[model samples]
Target: MKVIGKHLTVDMYGCSFDSLDNLEFIKTAMLEAVKEANMTLLNLSYHKFEPQGLTALALLAESHMSIHTYPELGYAAVDVFTCGDQSRPDKALAVLKSFLKPEKTKTTNIMRGDFGSQKDMKPRIKISIAPLRRVRNTSARVWSLLRKK
Candidate 1:
């Protein structure tokens, strides 16, 4: 099997209900998770439900990560799909699990970009991650303020 990427699908149960409903916390936690995974954050967007729950998506240079919350059930589903070895999906999952404090976590790892025929050609490249201090602050503020409305 030819593998070009790693994808992690995580199911977190028994998390803090209140935290899942907080958009600001979710965005910050997600950004922190991406940083912890050593992934490059390209962009991030999040939306809050009518009364409760939230969904956040982080676009990364490696790939993408998404966190969908079901506050009423105290559950969240997170996906961390990254190409290349530079990104650490496990580290990202650890950070998210720590923040959510889930009693039970189920994770599945999948190999992506598998080509049946081209097994010999392995393409690789190195990338530099830009500083996110300014972008992070601005995004967090916007998400937070929007949630309050």
Candidate 2:
């Protein structure tokens, strides 16, 4: 099958609840996971919720990864999606699981944008163009182009 990307969704149970609540720890784990997967990180954002929860997102050149932790429940939901064949989402998950030390974990691997079955079919991309007006600002023209999408 022709696949564009791989997505691994993980449900970690019986993990270290305290570590899950630490934003810095979570960030470190995520970065280490991304590196283990051989994916390039474009940016990252993480937030610690009130009472006890944390959510961290990492934007990657191949795709993205995210981890949402429920410390009170000792569970964390993690997702790793990568478009590059060299980027191993499984390896990333392994790294994360090591850090979380979950006693029980469930994971699902999904193949995204598979198109090989339709051998005779070609994807059609449609784009409509409009006459450009007198736009002096460079940024305005870029915005206008993006608005078409």
Candidate 3:
């Protein structure tokens, strides 16, 4: 099996509350990160919650980047996943750190795709679906018909 991508997850702590809660700032920061990381940005979306907090997502050609903020806790969770050898997810993380300025961070790096040889692979789980049942009220019926094979 071949390695295909890198996924970086960062738990940023003690970040600036204002920066995390600011939707516009997060938008700009995400864009800057994408540009600096050399990831191709296909689309960007964000939502600001009532009261506080925000969530932003960037759909990229390589993969995607997302950030969820907790202003009350002065924390933010960020994820950057990119496929291919040329994408630099670490650079994107650095860009976000510079803008958010977290006092402490816990970062994790994961190499995605199958990393073991074929012989070492575990057998996949197989699921079998039971036959559909007729009901008088089909529209409101709930189906519980899956079983492992």
Candidate 4:
């Protein structure tokens, strides 16, 4: 079996845009981003939210690219995620920022998937998480209460 995986995280802020109500413009931009990422697009869905703004999504074979626009506030939220090639998402994100003209942008990257990535991946028949602890001790309960806050 073979495994392939890549992870990327990008945070962008203070984006400047000409207008949010323009469906054609934003839709074009979204399509460009998907193509630039080298991902095959299966479908694209977009609509104007009205009063507030518009939300758009590009569904791709790798994953998805989405954006929310707030023209009134001169802001937008963008996300590009893929699993095959590591730099593809970031490259797409760069293209998006360049066109969107965001004032501020931050990015963090991390590997996604198991040790072998998607290779030999299978759904877990059983799930195991944190062991349930017996809550009889007063001090333990008090500690748990404090942690929750």
Model 4 misplaced stretches (Cα beyond 4 Å):
1-9, 115-149
TM agreement with the true structure for every prediction: 0.76, 0.76, 0.77, 0.64
- Model 1, span 1-149: residue lDDT tens: 55888889999999988989999999989989998899999999888997899999999999999999999999999999999888899999999988999999999877787875454345546554455776888899999999999
Candidate 3, which segments miss by more than 4 Å at Cα? 115-149
- Which lDDT values do the candidates have, in the order given? 0.90, 0.89, 0.89, 0.70
* Top candidate, metric lDDT: 1
Q: Summing lDDT over every window of 10 consecutive residues in candidate 3, give the lowest-scoring window.
A: 140-149
Residue pairs of candidate 1 with colliding backbone atoms: none
Candidate 4's residue-wise lDDT over 23-116, tens digit each?
7878887777777777788899988875657888888788877888888777777777676653388677777777777777667554455666
- How badly does each model clash, as a count of residue pairs? 0, 0, 0, 1
| Collision pairs in model 2 | none
- The total number of steric clashes, by the backbone 3 Å criterion, in model 1 comes to 0
* Model 2 agreement with the true structure over 48-79: per-residue lDDT tens digits: 89999999999999999999999999999999
Please give, for residues 24-142, the per-residue lDDT of candidate 3 as tens digits. 99999999999999999999999999799999999999999999999999999999999997879999999999999999999987777766744435656866443333353443343
